[model samples]
Target: MIARIWHGRTRVDDFERYSDFLIERAIPDYKNTEGFIKLVFLRKKTEKEAHFTLITFWKDIDAIKKFAGEDYEKAKYYEEDRKFLLEFEENVEHYDVFAEEYA
Candidate 1:
């Protein structure tokens, strides 16, 4: 499995609205994609901005390319994201998932 990590930030006031967008739009889009495993959304708010980290799991690099195109390292952004994001990052980090278990 591969874990793709992406980071973004929004104005503090837009935090909840952005989170809702992720839940309503992003999560569903990811779920519908082939080889999608799961995702975790992490957020931290400061006085000026709210930082968000999206960690998504996929079956392999081929599966990721299905969603991310041939340049899999580049970040994927939706049209609606422009409204909330402070800046558009060009790339995301990927890691090998060696172990996971449920208690």
Candidate 2:
């Protein structure tokens, strides 16, 4: 399995809106992607901002390419993101999943 991780942050005031966008829009798009396996969405809030992390599992590199294009390490974004995100992060991280368990 291949794991792709993306992280972003929004000001505390925009947190809820951004979160809603992720759930209502981003997640569904991921579900429709070919070879997409699972998603782990995480959030952390501070007095100033909220951090969001999206970890997506894929069957292989090609699977990620279907979503990320030829530059698989680069981050993907929607036009909606600019309204909430603090800055544009240019890249994402990927890892080779050697082990996992679901219960």
Question: Positional deviation of 61 in candidate 1, in angstroms?
Answer: 0.6
Q: How would you encode candidate 2's per-residue C-alpha lDDT over 35-61 as one tens digit per residue?
A: 999999999899988999999999999
Instruction: Tell me the tens digit of each residue's lDDT in model 1 across 1-103.
Output: 9999999999999999999999999999889889999999999999889999999999999999988899999999999999999999999999999999989
- Candidate 1, poorest ten consecutive residues by summed lDDT: 24-33
Residue 19 lDDT in model 1? 98
lDDT of 1 at 28: 93
Q: Estimate each model's TM-score.
A: 0.96, 0.96
Q: Evaluate model 1: give its TM-score.
A: 0.96
lDDT of 2: 0.94
